[model samples]
Target: MFTYVMRFLFCLLTILPLSLYAAVGDHFYYADWYYEILSETDMTVANLGARSASTPGLVYPTVEHNNKVYTVIELRKESFSSSYTFKNVDFTNYAPSSYKIKKIGDDVFNGTAIDPNTIPPCIEEIGARNFADRNDITSVTLPSQLRILGSSCFQSCANLQSVKGNFHLKKIGDGAFFMCQKLKTVELSYSVEDIGNDAFVSCSALESLIMPSAKTLGTGAFQDCPKLTSISLPSNLVSIGESAFLYCTGLKSIVIPENVISIGKRAFEHCDKAEYILFKPATEPAYVNWKGEAANFTDCFNADIESKMYVPSRKTYEHGIEMISFEDKPLTYTGLSPEISWKNNTPWPITVDTSNLPKTAGEHNVTLTAAFQNPSISLNIPYTFNIVKAPLKVTVNNSERVYGSFDQNYSCSFEGFVNGESESTVKLDLSYVTEANYQSPVGTYPISATLTPANYEPEVISGTITITKAQSTLEIQNLDELSNLKTGEGVIICWISNAPHSELSLGSETTASVELQKMSTLTNGEEAIQYRLIPINPGEGKVGLYASGSHNHEDAYTEFEVKIEDKAGITNVHTDCVSLITRPYEAIIIGKADNAKARLYDINGRLIHNGIDNVIRVAKRGVYILIVNNSRYEVAL
Candidate 1:
């Protein structure tokens, strides 16, 4: 009977009477009542923006055809604000106060023109019917510290378009915001736990809701909310009251969480467009009304859904793949057990147990398991896996040597070894072979390398041995002390080059002439030539001997000076060099010219021994001696 009376009064107030109109607009304008009539205004004000209108609905539709001559523009209709009777009237400004409000008493401003926006944030609770039946407020912002929204607080507030909420709100009282048709969204904070009966009923423009922390939805809480297409029932919600979603028709799917053990009768009665309802629990939730009336889960659904409800299971497979340890890939188990490939035949997903799966590389027998709590079922299967060795490539690097030089120092390197393992662990038989020998002609020869391993597979890349033509050089020998030669005496200059069949040419000169003595070629790619240089004239000059290579690779050059004495001296003793038996380290000679004398000194030009009779005294052993007559002769004894 009380419920009927409240609904009856809610319909009756839509057409408010004169007595109620006088009471509804008793709101404060700044600090005074909004209904206080100022002096009647026959003269119209040009700038309405300057009007001191602080209270809502104080000057609604201030200038329009509804204005009457005798009727003063009362800022308040007093009943159901903005009932549209506005005439010109005067407004007065009042001094605003800084008073702090903590709570609003019940019916303090019920069915009156109180603005929800004007409620100070210091207030923590709003009394029932505080702003009910008011047409001026377009939105409701809950106070920051407010925890409870009293029943019917904003009910029948026809123009209420939205409701802003905060995390501190814990409950929405019954019939709060009822019949607010323009409210499109209900995104309350997660701290809200209870939605009282008829809390948002007949909110036709409501399309979505997100109060996932709510545990109980009261009777008729969301009844007749037709535009709502989706609603996420809180995971912690234990009960949904009767007719909670009675006439909502736009929903396409419904998911009942495992915590929900009971669904009230007619809770989802007219949601005919919903294609499926997936229940997470194994058995259907009891569909009985809270009054202890017996009912089935199918009884609440529309006729289009009674035959479509059914329970199903899923499918999965277990197997393993062949891999190698040398590939440097290691395996560890994540509890999800990726080995068992699943094929779920239902709308929901399931998890698998990997406790028996392998964590290291080897051949092992394992089992995979999957369990489904809803429509309870379990699957177990056996499988096997193996790890093998990886293949590798070893190569002997290319080698280079001269044509006549032998170099057997062949080197090698490896590729495709993983996990820090090298050739030391595996026995290897590696051989490098080529067709070229130490005496082979200059050319590039292919060297094929092979490797046979005991514990691993092997591949090879062939290399090459290049025989390069050696550098050729020429040098004129016995020319170091060939100075002051007499006209009748000559000295042999021995020349040699590393290239066979090589020839040496002398540049034109004035002081000397050369006679070819002998030429020879040896088996080791060496060429030799001997030239005897005889001093012809007294003037001294330089002569150049240049050699060209035989194998077309090497070239060489040499230079030396020759001098001839004008006077004829005693028969040639040893100015250049002589054997130990023929010319001893001490030589004695008497010249026809009494002025001819020879003096000997050590290698440092210090006088060691001397002879005045044209005799030269040199060291007895192989120490060097410089014999000075008209010129110095460096002789090694």
Candidate 2:
């Protein structure tokens, strides 16, 4: 038992050191060991094989024994890894003098040398013509200061899922990211100015893109991106290169801006899924070069992808005006034509038909027909012409006299005025009189008339006629008893006659006046005349009347004596005082009566007040009068 124990102890001692040495050496092959054992494990390590160790979450270079480098090969942490390795060396501290690459996670990488000076002499950009076929990277966050992405950068990176941090980038070189089948999202910066030829071509997983600041697009810029459903081109873009958007089948519609002057060959060809192409040029008759050929257009529109051309109509001549009169010349219209086309080819010649035009002077509508050689292709256009008319002139003959007791007839004449001169006489009709009344008493009457002329509307006119009464005898009676009149008093002289008088003349032999108070014809055909005789001064006067008729009726004359007296004790005077009856509130004295000492009394004969200065003011409403110098003057209020 003792001999077997000694042999087993010796063999165990030798194999234990060898196993520890092999375990330590496995960390030296960090990349191989990581893929073999810890590729799927979740852990963090700062320094794997270096002289000095780094902090737990910070990655930096540290020299250790033997001047060797180490990094984390595959860290499957929840947030981010601190350090990583490529080919078993740490490249987190690499500068432009010594360019290197390192993978920090499953498909994530970091690079330190990003500017142009850090790149090789033959390469114009940091990643130009490099890494075209790399398929392992799933996401890349580039440096913030990267200005340009060179030709074919990251092209054919089939597994590249996303790219971030291109904030200061200015241009994207030719074929950059071309055929990156798995690339899903890439946000370009606003500082970017141009997109080079074939950029982003065949990026089938890219759904939406925005290039807000780019002004020019090179040839085939977005060709063959079938999964690209939407793209926002810059508003200030000026031109598009050949085949720029070929085979972009996912686009629904597009509007070409007016600022873009040229579009290259096949730029929008094979875009079969696009429903419309809205080409908005700046002006009419725009010239567009398509497929190396030029075409003129007034407006470019395609509703459903079927090509249709619009050709504007041209006016040949202006329409003439026609005069309105019986002796006017016949009117003829000519020279109305329009250019017509279909599918960019002229198919017909236009002809205007004015045969159905009316002979009247007014606006007339004419029909224009685009009659082609083929009857199936025809269109109609409606046109118009203007016609004028001369004004009408009317004159009526005045009658010397017309008896009011008999019916009468009259007429008016009309003429057409041309160049301020009468051309021909126009016929007038009596039935066109709108208003005519001649049965009234003798007076002047107006006649309202309107007439219609050929090819014109109704014309209005005005006329007048004088009417006179028939011959009749005029006589006055019952005025011989108007003799006793008082000073400042009025007497009414009345008379009856068998004929109505149009006027009457009155005269006085003394300083007295007479005024006609009322004159009216009674219902029995007899006339009544009344005159108010005012005895202004105390004297005897004669009031005469001369009645005259409207026509040839004989006039009659009559006279009466008016003795105006100033009686000192005249009582029970009538209420016909001229000044007192006219102005009932004021008191007035007769001729040569001064310092009269008047007294006022109401209609009931009751004394109310006294007056001075031969003037009285009655304060209440009633019939009152004044008695001056024992003479009573009655006033009716």
Q: TM-score for model 2?
A: 0.31
**In model 2, which range of ten residues has the least summed lDDT?**
317-326
TM, every model: 0.38, 0.31
Best by lDDT: 1
For each candidate, the alpha-carbon lDDT, in order, equals 0.53, 0.44
What's the lDDT of the predicted structure labeled candidate 1? Answer: 0.53
Error of 1 at 472 (Å): 97
Q: Candidate 2 lDDT, tens digit per residue, 4-121?
A: 9999999888877452332232333332222212221322222332222231222232222223333333222222333433222333344433432122222122222222222222
Reference-based lDDT, residue 226, model 2: 76
Model 2 residue runs over 4 Å out of place are 1-91, 94-125, 280-637
For all predictions, the C-alpha RMSD in Å is 23.4, 22.7
The positional error of residue 198 in candidate 1, measured at the CA in angstroms, is: 1.1
- Tens-digit lDDT track for model 1 on 96-130? 12323345555555544556665555556776877
